[model samples]
Target: MYVVIFKAKVRQFDDQYSQTANRMRELALTEFGCLEFNAVTEGDLEIALSYWPSEEHIKAWKQHPEHLAAQQLGKQRWYESYSVEVVEIKRSYKSGSY
Candidate 1:
């Protein structure tokens, strides 16, 4: 498994942001083979973690038209600064049951 870590310093959030976020999450999960998608915000910071099966899936997601538009909007409106990191999982551990 691989994880994409997205951390952003938010500028603001509006209704459009919420809608776009939900749409993107859905697309990632349903169309792009995302294993899991999660995001959270506190104060001015937002962090999202999306799990994927491979780099190919990640590249496909990145070039998605809607996502590309959202990235532009994020740069223009929603985020002040951001960083992304892709890392491979070397091992796994579980504690008890979910």
Candidate 2:
């Protein structure tokens, strides 16, 4: 498994941001093979974690047209700054099933 960590400094959000975000999440899960997606915001900070099966899937998602548009909008309006990190999960332990 792989995880993409997206940390952002929010500038502002509008209704379009919410709709686009939802659509993006759906598309990632349905079309890009995303295992899971989660996000949270507090104060001016936002963090999103998306799980994936492979780097190839992540690359395809990053270059997706709708995602590209959303990224442009985020840079122009929704976010002040952001960082993304992709990491491999080498091992795991779980106490219970979700």
lDDT of 1 by residue, 1-91 (tens): 9999999999999999999999999999999999999999999999999999999999999999999999999999999999999999999
* Colliding residue pairs in candidate 1: none
Estimate the TM-score of every prediction. Answer: 0.97, 0.97
lDDT of 2: 0.98
Candidate 2: which stretches are off by over 4 Å?
none
> Which 10-residue window of candidate 2 scores lowest in summed lDDT?
89-98
lDDT of 2 by residue, 1-98 (tens): 99999999999999999999999999999999999999999999999999999999999999999999999999999999999999999997888786
Score residue 72 of candidate 1 by CA lDDT.
99
lDDT of model 2 at residue 24? 100
TM-score of model 2 (CA atoms) = 0.97
